[model samples]
Target chain A: MKQKTITQSLSWLHTWSGLLFGWVLFAIFLTGTLAVFDKEIDNWLRPEIPAHSLDSREAAQTALDYLQARHPHARTWNIGLPNERAPTLSVSTGEQRRGGGQALDPETGELLQVRETAGGGFFFRFHFTLNLPRLLGIWVVGLAAMAMLAALVSGIVIHKKFFKEFFTFRPAKGQRSWLDAHNATGVLVLPFHLMITYTGLVIFYLIYMPAASDALFGGDREALNRALRGMPEQHAGQGRQPPQEVAGPAPLTALPPLLAEAERVLGPLASLSIHNPGRGDARIEVRPLLGNRIELTKGQSMVFDGVTGKVLRAPAESRPSLLTQRVLAGMHFAQFGGYPMRWLYFVCGLASCAMIATGLVLFTVKRRRRHDGEGALGAALYTGAERINVSVVAGLALACVGLLWANRLLPFELAQRGGWEVRVFFLIWLATLLHACLRPWLRAWQEQLGLTAALCLGLPLLNVVTVNRGDYIPLEVTILVIGGLLAACAWKIGQPAPERALRVRTEVN
Target chain B: MGLAIATGLWLAYSGMIALCLGLERHYKQVWGRPPSSSRRRALRATGWLALAASFAASVAAWGWAMGPIGGLGLVSLAGLALVLVLPYQPRLAIGTAVAGWPVLALATLAG
Candidate 1:
């Protein structure tokens, strides 16, 4: 009896926790899933950047030349080498807050005419940040992740016939079908779900569990960071005198030799950062590419004197704890995996999303039969939940596809173009919410899903007309096919029930 | 390599579905009668063998570290597909299991 009560209470906890945060969790999961292909999306968005064979040395030289001409006496210079997905050299100076960067064509060193759009990077940012204020969004996402963990644990505790029901699905049985799908998807990918949520929390451990660092390092964030990363604490340009004269120091040594040396030590280099450039106290930092290693933290790096191109410091050997943390983070972010692993992650992510969606739908389906005609608060709650279900599930899908349409249709020179695309997403979602409120729940679902399907299916044609790019047509067509199938499912869902069908037939007779 | 792994995964998935249906209770729901005891035993054994073959094929395709992860992913996907298929087409599901053996053999030989 005691164990039974514990299981019952756990069941209650799982249901409530999942219901309360299901919509936000769904959005996060969908965006994060899309972010697995962020680099490909970036390439598709910037059609002007034709694919090119990456020559890291040449790319680095172009970036250095661009930065020297642009920010001759700037405090810092960062250059990102061209890679497989993004075949362009990206150079930026100053801090991220003072955003000034451009993508240079790898072949010509000329700036590409790429529109100012966030592309897949926007979804990547929204995954964690939710496009809100930085600290607030991180805290909110972290809380949701914690809630997901709780739900996952309670769900496992409550499930009795876990393995027996692994391959069970009885369609058209209403709540039973939903429950079966939820159980099957959830149990099958339970490992992946747990790993993703835990690592997501760990990624923002500083924000989520700041008390540990505060107590251990006396609230010195940098010191705490250095300790956690297992690296020596070395401030940039430490104990250096400020330059008095306006004239800059002599031209810095060429980056080719330095890059070659850094590559020799640490495989292929990803990016190079020059701090205090053109000053006597200048230093260069080189970060290695993420190449098929299961380590999560950014790859090992080397520091060198800017003028002499001599190695100053090699990366410290990470402690076991640090290495474990990095591995977890790496698995969660999937930086080490190639294309197959990435696709696998994407599919698993989709399965997780399906699990959450089915759970939410099952809650209402189970209750609707018991409360449909009851003239009580229960029915009212059911109606409200149904509306929310339609709007969140189908409506968000519509909004996402709508964002892609906005991206293609919006003028190239439109002011704040990226902001407009996000606005389109929210506006469509808001419109669907209003529509769901006004229309019958079933009708609302059909309409929104149908719209999403249409938009997804039409995206390729829109792309061809607007960008005239044939390279990405195959991918767009695949998405369209998926959308078509979703639309068919929506249509089926909107059909009348057996009882309703019998009643209509009798009336017609 | 991709084709061989895909074929191996399908064979394993079909075998899992057949094993599930070999039980008297689930067999009645699908085919309106319990399977024969001997047939049930055969089905269960076949399922285990197919899964073992799938593991070997996956390991051969990907290395030791990635093979298990890939195999797990394939199982999940196949399980989902089987669930979706079993409700409406019970006979088709069993037939798929029988057909999968030859395909698996072909994939292995080709590799």
Candidate 2:
């Protein structure tokens, strides 16, 4: 094959593979991008959920008492202890009635807080898998990440001007405009792209390549886990709790003392988890979130043997290891980089979506032209693939952004807010796919892109109207980001006919 | 809890299977001749084993900072870097430098 043949084949491969993974990639990028501000958003969304409140131990125990009362025979209990990020403590009793996990309140044991939690960690969780069941979302994304890695490799292999095109972006010039968009998205945010893809794959490396364990670990995941599970203390249970009745909550340690000692010992308790609270074995563990004034924390658990108040094994405190992981966390989360980095990542993420978006558009662009000589069977197959691309990419964005629209419209006190949020997301996406399928190619692109742009542009206004933040409150950073992106989209979708842009640029030259 | 994790497990299973299919296609596309059917089968079998191994490693890596998959991310990032170098060998030295350094810095800050 001629070099041109190689280039074309790779381009063919990149375009199609990328289109296949585009929606998932966009979800991953968007969610992952938002996940960079996971903490900030958590802070923003759940303003009612107090920060630096009392650790979850007292709360966890209080929750545990209720859950234990509800289902004492549960084989196991898991308490989602809370801290700075989420003040609401949640408790899960084992085998309550069936396998289904039951929810409980932290304080007062009055079934604390549960309404369609669209805010807390919902956006964070929504990324990668669109909050699908773990297996479904993870696999879809893992496969996409693999495809993305392949596309990245093939994209590099095929680009003739890899270096010359570095940092070169020319606005609106036919396919050069498209190619520039691709190169700019890929290269300018090269670090973000590379880091995200690599980290994304690594984030789920074992799931994607379990063989690495056998070859790498020589067997026995437990021992390997021992090496890595940072705080062995967390796993070592606070001695066995004897049987307990609903004590209607007893005197628990005042959170203020715990906080002070916790800070003195563990460097400001970022979070607290209490198991079997208000019992003989009621355990309280104090730990830092991002440790005070010293370093970004990779949490350390000093489990207090509930009855004795003895510290458990705050083990695996390797400064080097912790620091390395923090950086990885930083790169992945975009926390260390702050607002500028956040915006950079957000843009990069959008660019990543744009990369997929443009790549998907390019698929149709290449196909719509008069096929020089490809056969009908080949054309049909190609056309079918384009159809899926249109529905999946544009449709998927419609689903995601539409969920935000849904959040506004959905009854706030609805019993299943989380469920409804997810449902609306899928429903919107599904509708888009169906609409794309029903429409002509050109119309599908224009209309869906137009709606997406409109939705994105209007997101901030909707938030302002629904959430009713005072004008005194500056623009929510997230809303501002969305507004900018939506405007960009509206511009892209509403750009004049290609011939016009070409004629204008050509005439100018 | 274990059953809930099974979803992630199945995901691993599907990815390995798809990877086999993808690699088979990729090799065929590259070499013109199809990879031997038996070889593809072998790759599938190996892929399963790799999937299982990586799963265990990930579980182990949990909570350990550069824990399970993060290490893999580091390595894969490196591998992908090498793959991208093929089309621009002259720029490799500079390219790797430009790419590799930030990761190194992140590793430092993360630690």
Candidate 3:
């Protein structure tokens, strides 16, 4: 095949494959970006969910009592402790109402101040769901993940100058500039590209390649879960069972002391779990899972029998799968944690988005000179694509920022507040896309971009309109991000040289 | 069915403009000679509108031609499909598949 054919073939591969999975990847990027401060966002959303004053054990005791009393037959329970991002102590007694789950006051047995607490879980779930049907979303996202992995690896192989131009970024070259941006972003954050993609696959590995089980353990979900989770059931009945109910109000140890002791022994407990706290079978599990700060992607969990107050079994950390799963999880979630690593992942994540955006631009840029070499028809197509690229890229930014604006501005009493917020997002994007397509290339580019810039630049001022989160909420971070994005957009459309380089060259000729 | 519905909706939503543009898109793909006549321009416009409308009609008739996943879902999968059919891949087919499908689907989901 000719060099051009090969490039064309890659182009075809690049174009169709990219459009297919672009949206899902976009969601992942969007959500994952928000997930960086998932906890903080959760707190911002749920103002009423109270902080836990009592220790994990105290909260555990109240939550346990609620669970045992309300959902004695629940199959499983999950307790998430308060963190820097979220102050609420939460308990899910059962999957269903019958199974009984509620967030309880850490000190009092009273019901938690619940107010539609979707919190960061919304973004977490949106990562997988893409707002599609449940498991379907997973499979779809999983497939896209594979595409990303392929794109990363193949992109490197196909580019002979991958190493030669590793640091090359020339802004005035139009399409060359987009190519540089794509290549630079892709190459510079290649580790992130690889880590995020591979890890993302692992994060949803069970769904993506359920065969990991077949290949390793013969396709058994239980076997896989047990193997990955490290033989949880085996240790369950090693000790004697406590009574079905609390044996006459046993005045257990105060939670604060237990928490202090647990912190002392386990080292500032990362996550706390409560199991059957009031029932004789009640237990409090203190999780010393390594956070993003430290490095424990494969978590280490310690179970404390609630009634006995004895650390039942201290299973020294066991083996975790090093195969794609562990390593991928570590890389994807930055689970082997730390602030520095988190920031690193965050930067890489943003770069990954930049890489995609650049690729889109490059697709148009390479074909850009066709106006002169190719003719008016070529220029027209170029103009059309340019409008689209602008719409999709900057349009998406506008929608995102608009959503934040809606969150602040939408009156709490507004019926369908959540739905309306979502609707507003789509409506704005649709309108922008339409507006972009209607204008001529240059005008559309500048105007749509200008609109995007205006929205972003005005965000900080918009926040100031409400005394709620916008006014009282921290502005420095929001201001910087919004300002930075607006500046970048402005530079892209407003900068004159890249678009005019060819014209000047033609004139010189 | 989901994909079909989505495709139909997209066409319903943005098809006319995209198709008219896409018509020029197809025309621009021709090698050597550039199309210049008024007749050719009208023909291209009509041709593209037909194609876009047919696609929308197909989805409308088929209810989910894009598969259960939806039309946008097909976008990423189409990338994989093209790779499968394309000859002389630079092994970057894998990378294209890797980066394209998910990125496409992710953006679709956001929409």
Candidate 4:
């Protein structure tokens, strides 16, 4: 065995680790980018909610009136206010604060007959969880995020001509072009890559690294959460008790004034929940919209007395340490700076996906040249790796658009339609892997990318035939642009072979 | 706000072009000649100045808190656009940057 220099060792680490985790990272990045417009996508998925310009207070009152009449005995009544981005008021009755809501037309106060679909929330969930069980998915994604951080650091360490090749890129040179693109995208968007990855890990910090929690709190997550909220530890083991029935139902206070006061304080409201609705001891908790600030106020709320409409507890100001954590999480969440900032995050995320995809392709391109020198086993492994690369990259993209197609194409009255949509997504992805394994490499890439392009380009027509709404023009336009790009990529893949690339290089020289 | 953001993006693009041209290899690639030391120094200085102005515009558009974050993204994307364009259309890359001066002036007056 020969001694290896630090750069050589780290270079080896970078290549293998990146290839091992690159597929998962690509999925995470692609879905995270889509999650940037989750609300808009949600709106598109459920087109029953028409776009409207309703005042928040008026909408809140309407939701209150509706909930009061229908769910008078419910323990908690939640009302999701319509906003500029999502113009659908939702009211749900449940023991929990969130989950299982019904959409309502804010103008008519009637329940909307919306079809069940997976919505853009699937992407947001899969971004962090990879469609695995909740805890298991988080751990898997946490490992992938760590691998990304490792790759970024080692990639910088091994690149000898960092500054000299800052803006260098040469097309039509095959392997060199891939390396250049990998370097350019990775380096140019380095800040976003680092910030997004680090913050993603920070979001589940205690779960990923529980040593501090274990050492201090004996590994009791509930106790740690109680202490963080400044709650007394004596009540740590006691779970939330269902609200006891009062002697008699009483008239609740008018919600418009409370909504006004809350709006004055919290900027714009997203939703409000009333505990023990119509009971004498009722309480109203108002939560602000997510994008009002860079710090995620996920659990922050203003509590008010239901009878007197007086403030019981205003939203707590995060301490410096908590604020730092929240801001970092918020950066990854990207719910601040309105649409423009979200667009920036989306572009950077696409670049990140491109960076990972290029790195994966570069691995195979580099290996293909040396495969003949290696034995039969190595050649077989190389072939397997190449097929896996195609399936993971192009396959996942096809599955994503296929999910949207399923939302529209599937039977509207079908039971559990959302579940079926997700199943369609996975089935498409699996089918792509099989196709890639069976077909020739170029044809596999060309066919899958071409199908994805056709699906994306055809989405507007599908929406028209099924949903028949003009509100989602922006989403359709964006899909069309992506389709055009994918078509270009498919065309390029079909045109260029290794021999042609070699010939072009020779001609240039 | 729209004018401010447009100015920010244009200046960021122009700044990245200046910085790219300051590098001797990129300079030769675009202009078919290597830049002298003084020319390169001037280009680098101009690049930094344009970037600073772009930061100001970003701040004007998004305010102090989110300004720097968005500004960095603008500059990075501008650099990325420059890199991708230089390989395929080197003349158009520099040509657009050079043409941005009038647009920047119009944005300044309107803003």
i-RMSD of all predictions: 1.8, 11.5, 15.3, 0.7
Model 1 chain A poorest 10 in a row by lDDT: A500-509
Candidate 1 C-alpha lDDT tens digits along A266-354: 77777888878876667788888774466764746788888888888876566898777777777778765467667778888899889
After superposition, the stretches of candidate 3 with alpha carbons farther than 4 Å from their true spots are A1-12, A15-24, A47-79, A91-118, A212-220, A230-249, A264-277, A288-300, A320-324, A371-388, A414-416, A441-449, A469-475, A495-509, B1-111
Provide chain B's TM-score, model 2: 0.39
Query: How well is each residue in B1-111 modelled by candidate 4, as lDDT tens digits?
Result: 777887898899999888889999999998899999999999999999999999999999898978888898898899899999998999999899878878778767866
lDDT accuracy of residue B36 in candidate 1: 92
Model 1 chain B lDDT-worst window of ten: B61-70
Candidate 4 Cα misplacement greater than 4 A, ranges:
A97-99, A231-249, A496-509, B104-111
Query: Which runs in model 1 stand beyond 4 Å of their true positions?
Result: A1-4, A68-75, A95-100, A235-261, A275-283, A305-310, A372-375, A500-509, B1-68, B90-111
lDDT tens digits by residue: candidate 3, A236-290? 4332354354444343334556566666666645555555444466566666534
**Index of the highest-DockQ prediction:** 4
- Candidate with better DockQ, 2 vs 4: 4
Compared to the true structure, candidate 3 yields what TM-score? 0.66
lDDT of 2 by residue, A1-509 (tens): 55567778897888777776765676677666566566555444433333334454566556556755875654345555565434545555532222123334444565634335465366677676667797788788778888888888898888777655553444445666667667655654455566778766655555666685677677656545455554354353333444455434433444455545565676534445555555555556665655232234544556665455555545346557545544554456544322433444555576677677667666655555544357777667666666677767667766666766776677778887768877887788778777767875545766876687677667667766776542313335555556566556656655677685554344223
By TM-score, the best candidate is 4
| Residue B60, model 4, lDDT | 96
**Candidate 1, pairs of clashing residues:** A296-A330
Model 2 residue A122 lDDT score: 67
Query: Per-residue lDDT for A26-131 in model 4, tens only?
Result: 9999999999999888888887778888898888888888987887778788888888788888899864445368888888888989999999899999999999
TM-score-based ranking, best first? 4, 1, 3, 2
